[model samples]
Target: MYNRKDKQLAQKILTFSCELEEGQNVMLQLVGLNGIGLLRALVEEARAMNANPFIRIEDTEIRRILSETGDKNFWKNQAEADQLPLMKKMDAFVGIRASLNIYEQADVSREANKAYADYFVDPVHFKERVNNTSWVVLRYPSEAFAMNARMPTQRFRDFYYKACLLDYEELAGAMKPLQDRLEQTEHIRLKGEGTDIDFSVEDQTWIPCFGKRNIPDGELFSSPIRSSVNGYISYAPSVYQGKPFDFVKLDVRDGVVVDFDSSNNEALEEILDTDAGARQFGEFSFGLNPVIEEPMHDILFDEKIYGSNHLTLGNDYEIAPNGNESNIHWDLVCIGADVYLDGEKVREGRTFITDDLKGLNPENLMQ
Candidate 1:
């Protein structure tokens, strides 16, 4: 039997998250786990609103088998399939991730995984899905994810729902001042233990994503000028594809990561060397979700930790384009960073200093 909560969450994804419209066609993709009640709710919600909903589920077991055996060229040919055409036809895309095993691909070597991703998954998802559709990606609470978070299974489920189903309208209204400030700022600076960085976002558009592109989303993001990033930043541990990157440090010189390190030093270097744009700073953003307090080994959640800021490497989204394009867009988070904008100590330690942003003052919103 499916829980009523599943149906509730699915309704939010269709109605609020993706804004299912009349006559629109949506593609729902479930990974590694199933939520049949949520599936029913999504289909019914779509049809009730005159939208078409269809699902294409992919299990991790099958993907693991493909990655474990498929050669580089085999993956390349798979990429050549016409999935792009079909994906482009999608007006809305919703991806549900509830993996039973976080380390489901532990047997697949890193090199094999990278090659397969470069050819197949990355091309279709990044090049096609991200830029084209009204999309939202979210993780369903699962035992494995709860274990990674060091929380009890049921407690984590409660946390997940509370974080995802925020009153975004109130949050967006509160962020208007900050968003306006970002639009007019030329240079921004950040400082903290093992971190001090400078960058400019003079003309770049600033986007405040409150439960839109990402469920549990509370961020105001803008890409710095590709050649304007300077100084260094030490990020808290973050995970990518089930691998933990801890104490990740990067030295930026003229917008490029000239020096970098992480728990897996060699792997970090290889990731940055994916392409030229991979070495350049592609994204800079703040985390504003007050309830999400710490890292959970999940970017979708960690990147919204209230007191953190994430600096990403690789392609910047068109919403705040910096012209740095690559197959990678890794969001590395820095905790307890003292953020300074245009010489003013505006926001430090996730707590705000500027009165202009008093609208977002946690005291006002959290209750």
Candidate 2:
């Protein structure tokens, strides 16, 4: 069952993600094996807010097929004819992800993943679908996910729920200083143990976004100039869905990932080698959610961690001031690292100066 707190949390999650407006039609996609209760609660919240809500539950087996079939033509056509229609019809979309098998099988084809990536980069549909929607992707805990996190199932859920309840306004406020700093500097460098990278920003390339009607968890993001990255980046081991990628070290030069090595994961190499644009940098963003604790090895969850951090490679949504090149956007998460714009540390391990921000309603700041 569901308790009042759980229901409240569900509503808050919906509110933060969808921000349903009166009379808008909201569509939610829930992975069938996880978070049905939360989905129901979200429906109720949408109704209460006078918005029409629709819920579609997807089976994990379908995902397995897409990951295994390497069926590009089918998905490419579907994106143009089917998914695009739904995007135009809906006011907003909220995706609730809960996977029963994160790494259902290690034998699945990396080529299939590449095929899907290629399909997304379809020029006509990518512009139409990505640019027109107000959307969000969020996560819920499941037993399989807990196993990957190496925590009890209940503990994982507790951490997830607690993180979701964090103050969005405070989180947004904390990111302002960093955003301002990025606006002032043309080049930013990232340095860490086993990682040293430098990337140049376009003269007028930064995107500054405030909270909008649909996306409540607001943050600033932009695409790095296509050929502006240099040096190496070592991705810490991460588990996606349920599959794990070994530590990956990429040697980037002239805005492209020219050389790459992974401890045990050859699939990453295959991805970067698939296309010219695939290896180039796509998007850069700083996480703003204060409630997100630490690196839990999940990109979706890790990117939302409170404090200031940036992600490069792959562009999905049409972020403001976007480079608008590749349709394949992959988000890489980094945490517990200092973020500097020019020379000042805007984020010292997740804490940002909140006093310098304007239009930040304190009443709405996250606790």
Clashing pairs in 1: none
Q: Model 1: runs farther than 4 Å from truth?
A: 34-37, 80-82, 106-111
- What value does the lDDT take at residue 233 in candidate 1? 92
Per-residue lDDT tens digits for candidate 1, residues 228-310, read 89999998877665566767999999998888778888678767877899898778898888678889888899999887888
Q: Residue by residue across 268-301, what tens digits does model 2's lDDT show?
A: 6655555666677777766655445566666766
* CA lDDT of each prediction against the hidden true structure: 0.82, 0.62
TM-scores for all predictions: 0.94, 0.83
Residue 171 of model 2: what lDDT?
58
